[model samples]
Target chain A: MQSELHNGINVDIQEYADLIEESPSFQDEQYAALVTSAQNLVSAARSARVTSYGSEEGNGHMGLCFYFPTQTDLDSTIGDAYADLGLSQASPIWANYVNSSTRTTNND
Target chain B: MNLVLATTILLFLTITILFGCSEDRVTRTGIEPEADNQTWGVLIYAAGNYEGDQLSGPSMSSSRAVATVRVMETELNSPQTMTQACLATPAAQGEVGIYDVEFSPRQPVGLLNSELVANLGSVSTGDPQTLRMFLETSLSQMHADHYVLCLAGDGHGWQGMMGDYNNELGMLIDKLREEIESVSYLLPGGKFDILALYARNMGTIENVYELRNTADLVLTSTFNVEQPHHKIIAEWYRDLQSQPELNRDELAAYMIDAERLAQDTSEAVFFTTLWNTNTMNDVAAAFDTHSAQTGLRPAQLRLRLC
Candidate 1:
């Protein structure tokens, strides 16, 4: 997503917050309340913009990853909730340590 | 006299085989030696109506469901834990019937009667109502001092666990919570002992937090659940029998130990989290305070262990 300028300056965390607050989709209850809650947290932290990862345009400012002051801060803030949604599953299912050919079936 | 007796016995046996007993009748009337001491109730919901690349094993939910039920049968019949566990698992798109497993018979699921399922008409395996009916029926008719509800099959964390070929929404965690509560209300005594998520990559922090108030203990892995998921469970029951009453942490530790020894799936090698649901409020409180400080929209902070 293009970072729209505020007063002709780079958008800061506060501006990001305003954008998130305005979007009705963020609070959509159709999804799990937990998903909504997690997204809301990420939206609030986007303002920090201390670190940005992911693509900016097509995916709409999607890949930015922020750096936190401390690991504990991250865990207490959004990391814990993020992990719950299976976001870490974004990692490759097979880490090469385990051969896929022999992957055990949860089924028979 | 001998010929007459032999012919009469043969005719009697044939009649009994043809119409003597029904599976449902056996389930309602049959008695296990341990019924009075039966503390654990195992209920499995397997939603395998379709297949995709992101799945494991036979890819047939029904077969795997029985495979798991069979593995538990072996454990329950073992000399060490003959009377410790009782089970009822529903696999595939089937009617809502809880098969209370009995080991002496070596049946796939002891209320096993394919005829019963066919006659009743099957429900989509992913329907929460399926679970509700199973629990409601089992608790009312089966004897158990406690219970363990196992939801096996593909799990997309809080997105939902069991998927139905018929229903797009499938069985969400909220629906599961409602069913479990309903069972507890119908059969009140002990807290619902545990809710086991035997699906893949389910050990998420948020999912567990959402279930903190749902059960006393939650057993699930954060990564993809490797094959032979039922082996660890059987052994856990065996061990728990000897160690009868463990607090949440102790039970979690035991499960971790069982997984290490029996399950070889590398995906299941490390990502297991035991939620003593009762203690989750404190954990959630920590997150809530930080989220409060971070405001409504927080950043995905990258932090490393020192």
Candidate 2:
């Protein structure tokens, strides 16, 4: 499970980096590092059974929460990022971060 | 020859008078002057906690009542304590106060006990239906310049949960709007001036937008819970009351800043407005201007997710 989670994170990071590079305006190293760090934190949390809960029958538990600085920050950053990348205003998957430790029940 | 001379002179005089009147007439172009007396009415409703005992419900109600009392005591011209302020007085005629009431579990339709019954000048409270009736009657009887409704409890856009069942915030706002609309019929010249709104997070934005077709402006926080910033809110209220010259847009901008500061704890703060498209840009420009004037760097915050 840990290796699988690590692989998933690696793939996501590569995709994010590719998207960032495609938009030359957001190629700054600071932005790249922030994304990478956040991804790693999420990946580590996902892999550890200490965070995730697995039921005896089969399925794994899932819960997610993102701790942004504030609602305004979230709005501005997401809006600006989407505008810079010429992306649509619909909700992006990047905003979702799983809180594995909080997961208690699993329904397969 | 005498009749022709008289008719010609009369025609010339009429033409001259018409031209002079046109030139002297007021065009009515500039902005209207602000009113002398500005009354801000804030109403907060917190109900539907049935599982708890009657005492618990009233306790929560009293907490909100205390908050309102504090805001009034500090911001209003009068300096009365909460208990004394609840009582009716000459100052109470123009003062800000809260009417808090709770209902017993068995008698959910009626009010258990009303605190401001004796001093029922302009403010009153009871069960939801009773409160609605009072507001409708009072608005019809009196003239209010500004109206603010702060619904303090759990609410979704169309659904609300105070205790067990779900209620509709939109419906409540609609009811209030209907009451106010009826009251407008009795005003002088059958018209009244409507100002902005300051409300809690529970469905305020949606509610404001729905009711604000008749109002001038609406201000609300984005969160769904109440984090009371009495000091800051009172200060902002005082600032607005003092500056009768500020326009609606300017007042809205100031409120955005106040909400941001109230919601944010860090040195840096951020805020957005659904009504004002250029609000963020204005805030950024203001920060830049202040920074240039003071030669100090504003606080920095990196956006991780938004």
Candidate 3:
């Protein structure tokens, strides 16, 4: 179902579903999206961890963990987790990454 | 004897006139004539393609306009190769003479990853080469007085590309620094007055030091990670063209105001500045005040590392 939330964010669960159904590329790859997302997540995680070390060399490392995930499982988990933390579904950076990754994985 | 002397004088005058005319022709066509001392030069470097991201909005139509205005205001002459009417000429005889150049490449959806990698490589290669070429050509030509570089595009400091899925902003900055140093080595005495970056997501305090290390001043937007508002930017260019004395802080304040107006019905707008120690810190301070007034937190990223 598609719905608009109070914080000016929009959520369309079916839109995610449609993306999976339509992508031919997603069909061709064997867990390609999953791998891509995992890589991104790993990179982001590493960046975040480095920054968390409080070293001067890692000052701008916070943004590293904030990347698009390519894996479906990770996408769903992260999305749901963020949603629980109050990030709206309409947030393009996080939501789009999650939706696209999930769609690619579902199609495969 | 008097008639002979008069005839000789007339012939000499005629020859001199003809030679002068020929020289003028050569200067007008083959070479740029010497500009007056009052003339200044501006170079605009528009780099990094975003394929129109959601946060930053869309690609700008008036980037060319900004370049053009800067050129016209400075009354400098641009290269024949940069035939665009709005682009300014190089400076006559200063560090500002050498200007770096970079361009963004177009990309489609599925090709984002590969395209990003390829373009990053090209950007790196082009960045240094462009600066080096500008320095060589400017010094040899000796036509510029000071140099100003405008790195126009979507920017996010320390982070890779802001709007695009493929770009790494950190990598791009590193490449730019490398190229700047390379150019500096080639032209040890030359100077870059400022590096005006027309981009987004780089308004915070942290980005300032990283950016200011390479250039005298860094001008960019604070938030709204998409393409900047065209009319606002055009207007800003117009103002700068009319009044070159406008300090960097004044420019930052204006950008913050524009950002506020643009984001009134949307999201928060932010921006900041990093100036060389010699530059007036008032501009950065003004930017902070404006950002705070608009409920946007100013990242105090200014440091004296260089």
Candidate 2 clashes between residue pairs 3 or more apart in a chain or in different chains: A74-B306
- Expressed as tens digits, the lDDT of each residue in B244-298 for candidate 3 is 4555455445544543443342333333333342222332333233222222111
Positional deviation of B118 in candidate 1, in angstroms?
Answer: 10
- What lDDT tens digits, residue by residue, belong to model 1 across residues B257-283? 666665544333334444566555444
DockQ, computed on Cα atoms, for candidate 3: 0.02
Reference contacts preserved by each model: 0.02, 0.00, 0.00
Q: What is the C-alpha lDDT of each candidate?
A: 0.46, 0.33, 0.36
Candidate 1 stretches greater than 4 Å from native: A1-108, B1-34, B48-62, B78-96, B104-120, B187-190, B225-227, B240-252, B265-269, B299-306
What C-alpha RMSD separates each model from the true structure?
A: 16.1, 21.5, 17.8
- Cα error, residue B176 of model 2, in Å, equals 4.6
Off by over 4 Å in 2: A1-108, B1-62, B78-128, B137-149, B161-173, B186-209, B229-232, B244-247, B265-306
Q: Which has the higher lDDT value, candidate number 1 or candidate number 2?
A: 1
Docking class of 1: incorrect
TM-score of 2: 0.38
lDDT of 2 by residue, B176-274 (tens): 455445545544333223322323333222243334433443333334334443433555555554563455455555555665444444432222232
